[model samples]
Target: MALLDIKGIDVSYGKSLTVKNCSIALDPAKICSVVGESGSGKTTVIRAVLGLLPGGGSVTAGDIVYENRSLLKLSKGEWRSLRGRDISMIFQDSGAMMNQTRLIGKSFVEYIRTHESISKQDAWKKGAEMLGRMRLPDPDRIMNSYPFQLSGGMRQRVGIAMGMTYQPRLLLADEPTSALDVTTQAQIVRQMMELRDEYGTSIIIVTHDIGVAAYMADHVVVMKDGRIEDQGERGYILNDSTNAYTRKLIKAVPSLGGKRYV
Candidate 1:
């Protein structure tokens, strides 16, 4: 059975229908990438699954199921229990999402305590260990620093470390690398792939970069104007898809010296 299934969901922001009849099924340990231009509703789909829709936004129809349970029917208390332990999310700019006034260690420790019953000292040690696993040097010093003290790459790694703390069954990343430089982007992408390999975590990544999608996803879903324009296995979407929009996006990928990156 699929680890997560989104069935014919229509999402709305107040009266405006933003996502229509979207469906996706992700199996255990698989990576699925949703690619689309801005406002195409790719982010909206994942946000709905995580129940993090904006204040006025909501899933108006159909259902989201995770591990045989209906996520749409979960209560606030149930969702609180499920979010950090079973499913975690990494945002576009993790540093920006953090409280700048607080030290990174403080935020991380609080985050850990929220999902697990642990003392402050134990949580701090665990958080440092996770940061070390993500390859950040001198994890102890990192814990003492504030988010702004670290570079963009470092901040993103910290986000990944926190998200992977519980070894969640599913991870949702929304344009997680968009705010970083090329080298940082590559590092973050590689790290995410490594997490999947190490923990067998299923991932759903939302990105506008088709090249990244092709490189990281087992399945590629192309969205346009609030609907899925095309979807299939990576090879099919990359080489065999006849959909005009999909073809156009693929062709738009940058090439250097006659070699296309994807």
Candidate 2:
């Protein structure tokens, strides 16, 4: 059985529809990237999976099933119980979402304590270790610093560290590398791939960059104007596309280290 199944889901803001009957089934420990241009409903799909649709937006039809249970049917409390434990998300500009008044360690410890029955001291230790794993130069100093004290890249890595600390069964990433420089983007992508390798976490990424899809996805789903334009294994999307939109996406990706897109 598929680990996560999104079947025939329709999302909307007010009465105007966005995602129309979009269906995707992801296997455990694999990466499936949802690719598209802006406003193509790529990020909407990620929000639906996470059940945070910005108030007015909602899943008006269809169901999201994780481990064979429908997420739409879950109560708010039930969903909360499952969200950070079984599923986690890496948001675009996640660092900017952090509270400026609190030290990074305070926020980190609080999150860990909320999710696990650990002492604040232990949570602090765990948070520091995770930061080190992300290759931060000084995990202790980072923990002691405020969000404004760190660089954009550092802040982004800290966010990634926080997201991966629990090692959830599934990870949702929304344009995780879009604002990052190429080198930092590559590093973050590699760290995420390592999480899949070391912990067998299933991942769904919403991105406009086909280069990121090519680097990390096992399966690819292309969206255009709020619909699935094309989908298949990475090889098929890269080497045997039958859709014009998919072809355009492939052509847009810059050649990497003399490696062809195909």
Q: Give the clash count for model 2.
A: 0
133-193 per-residue lDDT for model 1 (tens digits):
8898999998999999999988999999999999999999999999999999999999999
- lDDT (10s digit) by residue, model 2, range 67-117: 989998899888877887789998888778799999999999998998889
Lowest summed-lDDT stretch of 10 residues in model 1?
253-262
Model 1 residue runs over 4 Å out of place are: 259-262
Error of 2 at 250 (Å): 1.3
lDDT of each: 0.94, 0.91
Model 2 lDDT at residue 101: 94
In model 2, what lDDT does residue 23 have? Answer: 96
